[model samples]
Target: MLIDTHCHLDFPDFAAERDDIVARAHAAGVKQMITISTRVRKFPEILAIAEKYPTVFCSVGTHPHNADEELDIPVSELIELARHPRVVAIGEAGLDYFYDNAPREAQAIGLRNHIAAARETGLPLVIHSRSADEDMAAILTEETGKGAFPFLLHCFSSGPELARVGVELGGYVSFSGILTFPKSEELREIARTVPLERMLVETDAPYLAPKPFRGKRNEPAYVAHTAAVLAETVGVSAEEIARITTENAFRIFSKMPRV
Candidate 1:
């Protein structure tokens, strides 16, 4: 069995066939999926999806891109909302200098708030970082020094330095369909060196479909393709990759019921 630890089922791309998308994922051997949140105000929509499906779980926090829009969202509110049974993580939050969708200062402040919620609730932080490695590394290092919090670099596409820092702090790295792209050889190399115990896999769907499905709509079903290449890169069997990532997922998202 495979677990797609991160995805966005609430995105309109799946609006027409949301149930079918999730059904196909189960048919393809993905037994569990976590529909991640990007905006705190969308928690009801995210929660409704999770409540409607037994295998789907969710997270609650603002994406770095929308940080400015949700700056008033209190850490206390995030912690409170996370009390829902199906809400399993604290964020799809972090810095994204590549887009600069939100002010850099707001992004940093939002990231820190989400980190605080994760630390307080004991739920893992689901993070996204791009083109902001220097500040990301410094912040994670500073945050780790203040107090340890569980986290994973979701859809990881960063430098070796940040990857190493994440592992050093006992956090995990989740690879997506991007790993199957030919230009991602460097990323595969990083995957090779990352300890298996600290690795996870996701599709980040409604985007990043792997080879054959590349440029098409992605869903949890295609996590198999990413997992296959990840197995090849890490010198492990496909079944072993399945076992390891699933084990790691359960470890961090401990709120999920054992299957």
Candidate 2:
């Protein structure tokens, strides 16, 4: 079985046929999925999706792109919200200099808040970093030094230094469909070196669809394709790759039941 450790089922892209999407996922051997929240304000929408499907779970955190708007959200509130049975992790949060849609300082402050929430609640932080590796690595390293917190560099396409630092800090690194692209040789190289136990597979769906599906809308069902490529990159059987990643998912999102 496979678990899509990260996805965005709440997005409008899936609105027209959400139930069918989940059905297809289960049919594709994706036993479970986590629908990530990009903003706490819409958490009810995210939660509704998880609540509607027994195999689906969710996280609540502000994406860096909306960090400035959510800066006022309290860490205490994040901790409180995470108390729910289906809330398994925190943040799709981190730096995103590639877009610069939000100020860098605001993004940093927001990331720290999510980190604090993760540290306090023992939930893995779902990090997103792009074009801001140095600051991202430095902040993650610094915050982790204060006290360890479980986290994953979700949909990772960062510099090797940041990947190295995250792994060194006992954090996980997830690969998305981007790894399957012909031009992602460098990313595949990094994937080869990331310890098998710390690796995870995600689609970051409604975004980076895998090879044959590239340029089209992505969904949880497509994660199987990413897993297949990950298996090749990791030098293991497709079944072994699925087993390892699903195991890693349970280890990090300990709140989720093993069934």
Candidate 3:
């Protein structure tokens, strides 16, 4: 069974035909999916999606791109929202200098606060860092010193240096459909270097669809394409890639039930 570790089924892209999309995911061998949260105020919508679908789960926290909007969400509220049985992770949060949609300082503060919530709740934090490796690495290192909390760099597009820092800090790295892009040869090389035990696959669906489907709307079903390409890049069978990555996901998101 395959697990699409990061997806956004809660987004409008799937609103008109979610059941059909989910059915396609099952047909494509995806057994479960996690709907990532981008804003604290929008978490109930995320939760509603998860609760409505047995195979879907949810994460709670703010995305770095929306950092300014959720800046006021307290550590207490994050912890409270995460207590829901369906909320198995915390974040889609981290620094994103690539867009600069939110202030760098605010993004940094949001990341640290999410880490604190993760430390408190023991839920793995789903991080998204882009073009801010130095600050991202520094914050992860500092947060680890305060208290170790589980986390993973979701849809990782950062440099190899940060990938090494992530593994060194005892975090996992999840590659999304972006890995299948022709220009992503370097990212594929980085994927090959990350230990199999600390690797995962995601669709980041409603975004970044893999090659052949690159320009289209993405969904959990397309995770197979990313996994297949990653397996080829890592010199492993697609089945092996699916097995290990799903296991890695379960290991980091300990709230998941053993299957």
Candidate 4:
């Protein structure tokens, strides 16, 4: 079974047919999914979704885009929320220089706090980094020096250097539907270099749908397409890729119960 390690099931895009969406994922062999958190304030809603679906899990913490809005959220609060049985990870949080939706300093501060929470709780931090590889790499390295923490560079589309830094820091790398794009040869090459054991696949729906599904609303079901491309990129069979990524998912999101 494949695990969609990162997705936003609480988003309105899935509200109309949420049940159908989950059913499709199951039919597609996506046995599990972690609906990531973008705002600590809305965690109750996210948690509600997880509670509704037996196969779904959740995370707690703010996204970098909304970091400034939740600056008052302490690491202790994140730790407390993560104590929930359904909350399996922390923070779709990190630097997002591409949008600059939140102040860079605020994003950095929020990331550090989330990292601390992950370190303390032994949960994986679902990091969302974009157009800030240098800063991302520096912060990850600096934080690891403070002490190790489990993390996944979610929806990675960064340069090879950042990928190398993430792997070297013992962080897992999750590829999104972007991996199936025709012009993503560079990303595929990076995937080739990453150890299969440290790799994961996600859809980040409702966005970045893979290949034939591109421009359509994405869902957990489409993670299989990315997994197929990752298999080709890494010289493995599709079944092998699914097995490896599912294993990697449970390894990183250790709080998630096995099926």
Candidate 5:
């Protein structure tokens, strides 16, 4: 069985046919999915999706793009909200200089707050880093020193140095549909070297659909395509890739019940 470790099934893109999308995912061998949260304030919507689907779980954190709006959302509140049975990880948060939709400073501050919540709750931090590797690594290093916490670089599109540092820091690296791009050979090399025990796969659905399916909306069912490419890149059977990555995901988000 496969699991789309990170997706946005809660997004409006699935509002009209959410059940169909999820049913298709299950039909395609996707046993579970984590509908990631982008803003703490919108957590109810995220949680609602998880509650409605037994195969779905939720994460609670502010995305870097929404950092400014949620910078004031206390870590304690995040911890409190995360106690829910359906909430598994704490984020989709980190720095995103590529967009800079939120001030860089605010992004950094909010990331630190997320780190605090993760450390306090002993829940994994689901991080998003884009064009801001140095600062992201620096903060993760500093925050881990304060207290150990699990974390995963979701839909990772960073440099080898950051990938190296992330694994060395005991964190996992999750690949997305972007890995299937023809120009992503370099990223594929990195994926190849990632230890199987510390690697994962995601679709980041409603965006970044894999090749043949590229330039189109993505969803959990397409994670199989990404996994097939990863299996070829990493020299493993797709079934093996499915088993291990699913196990890695469960290890990071222990709060999520196995399907």
Candidate 6:
């Protein structure tokens, strides 16, 4: 069985056929998925989606792009919402200098707040990092110094240093369809360095679809493609990659029930 540890099921892209999309994931061997949150205000929509699907779970927190808008959301609020039975993680939050959609300061603040919530709730923080690797690593290192908290670097596409730091800090690294892109040889090299026990796979769907399906609307079902490439990159069998990543997902998102 495979688990898509990151996706956006609440987005309108899947509205017309959300049921079918989920069924396709199951049919493709993706047994579980976590519909990630991008805005704390839209958490109701995220939660409703998770509530609707027995195998779908969710996280609570804002994406860095919307950090400015939700800067006022306290760590307590995130902790409270995460208490829901279906909420398995704390965020899709982190730095995104590539977009700079929100103020960098606001993004940093939001990230720290989410980290605090993750610490308090014992839920893994689903981090979304982009070109801000240095700052992201700095914050993660500083925060971890205060007290350790579980986190996963979702959709990882950063430098080797960030990947190294994440693993050194005892965090998991989740790869998206980006891993399957022809030009991602550098990324594949980075993946080679990360420990298999600390690696995960996600689609970050409605966005990055892997090769053979690139330029298409991605869904959880396509996660297998990324996993295949990851397995090949890390010199493991397809089934072994699936087993290793699934186990890593369960370990980080411990809040989710095992199948």
TM-score of each: 0.99, 0.99, 0.98, 0.99, 0.99, 0.99
**Regions of candidate 1 where Cα sits further than 4 Å from its true position:** none
lDDT of 4 by residue, 117-233 (tens): 999999999999999999999999999999999999999999999999999999999999999999999999999989888999999999999998999999999999999999988
> For residue 175, what is the lDDT in candidate 2?
94
Residue-by-residue lDDT tens digits, candidate 2, 19-107: 99999999999989999999999999999999999999999999999999999999999999999999999998999999999999999
- Model 3 lDDT, full chain set: 0.93
Q: Which ten residues in a row have the lowest lDDT in candidate 4?
A: 250-259
Cα lDDT tens digits for candidate 3, 38-117: 99998889999999989899999999999988888899999999999999999989999989999999999999999999
lDDT per model vs. reference: 0.95, 0.95, 0.93, 0.95, 0.93, 0.95
Per-residue lDDT of model 6, residues 10-67, tens digit only: 9999999999999999999999999999999999999999999999999999999999
Question: Any runs in candidate 6 off by more than 4 Å, and if so which?
Answer: none
Cand. 2 TM to true fold: 0.99
Clashing residue pairs, backbone N/CA/C < 3 A, model 2: none
RMSD in Å for all candidates: 0.6, 0.6, 0.8, 0.6, 0.7, 0.6
lDDT of 4 at 62: 94
**For model 1, what is the error of residue 170's alpha carbon versus the real structure, in angstroms, after optimal superposition?**
1.0
lDDT of 5 by residue, 26-56 (tens): 9999999999999898899999999999999
